[model samples]
Target: MNDQPILLILMIAVGLYTFNLWREDCKNAQAGKPSPSALPGATPASAKACIIAALGALVILIAETWGELRLGLSDQQSKITVLFGIYTLIAAFIEELIFRGFIVIENKGRALRWAGVAMASVLFAALHPFLWKWEDGVFAWTFSAKGWFSTAAVFASSLWFYTVRFASFNPHRSLLPCIVAHATKNMGVILIKGAQGFVVGLF
Candidate 1:
């Protein structure tokens, strides 16, 4: 079975859902209670949080890239096209909305929240195809030491995303920082892949 159709449908679904959430957030802001959602909050603190989170992502990505080079690990990334790159960018936001926005347990104690973060991070890392692959509608499992290193890096980044969402720097628990951090990492991956000649054509 072709995967493009499935990916297209999934992308549309996520786009619609994210748009609805933004609409709801707009209404909430008008009502003076935005709650914890994916809205990029309007405040200096929000901007600062995004910058800090993005810098942290840069650090992690740099280290991961260096490690991959040192280990002589080939880039397992799929070929990049304009459409694929766009989808990946949107995915950065949608993933944060789901993993960092929906999976969070606000108003619960710190222990429970951290527990949820850990579980979400594991699930996040596992879904990235480092330990498994799905192609032509067939699923297969594969792993390597280098793949484990990459997966672990993903897990660590997820933890940082969660941290920026709930850290004291972001008192409103805004998802902006999480989105920024995720986008930074994804863009870094794309650039690295392009530099390494994994990118095919832009379109």
Candidate 2:
């Protein structure tokens, strides 16, 4: 079975989920009870935070991909560059909405919020199917060393995004920083992989 269709369906699902969040926020605003954390507009401080988060994410991506860069590249080109790009952006937005926007925003008090963050981070990591492999059209759990490492890396990345989502001291919470950071990380990975492909082609 081709994984591309599965990925496309997942992307659409995520997009719909994000759209529902936006719709709900709009409805709440029209009802004269605006949500404080309703995807607030980015302020100057948030913009700075976004830059910081993006840089941090980029550093992480570089570190993680360094081995891949050093290794001999594959001559085969990526067929899903455009699909992957769109998917990454949509996935990042969906993750922010589910983990940071809904979970963190709905939970009250510091303790609850932190708990929510932890739960969401774990869920976020687990939801990433890329860490595992599918065999004979069935999902398989190898629990290999690489799988564990990938899952851990994903968990850490999710935690970083969550931190950025609520890093602002402002009253309103903006997910812009987290989204920017996530997108930066994804783009960095894509660029590195593309470079690897180019290097391989030269061989």
Top-scoring candidate (lDDT):
1
RMSD (CA, Å), candidate 2 to true, equals 5.7
Off by over 4 Å in 1: 1-6, 9-45, 75-77
Off by over 4 Å in 2: 1-45, 67-81, 105-107, 135-137, 169-171, 198-203
lDDT of 2 at 181: 86
Q: Best candidate, TM-score-wise?
A: 1
lDDT of 1 by residue, 3-108 (tens): 3646755785787687567657856765777657435542224577889999999999999988888887755555666556667777887888788877888788
The models' CA-based lDDT, in order, is 0.79, 0.65
Q: TM-scores across all candidates?
A: 0.83, 0.69
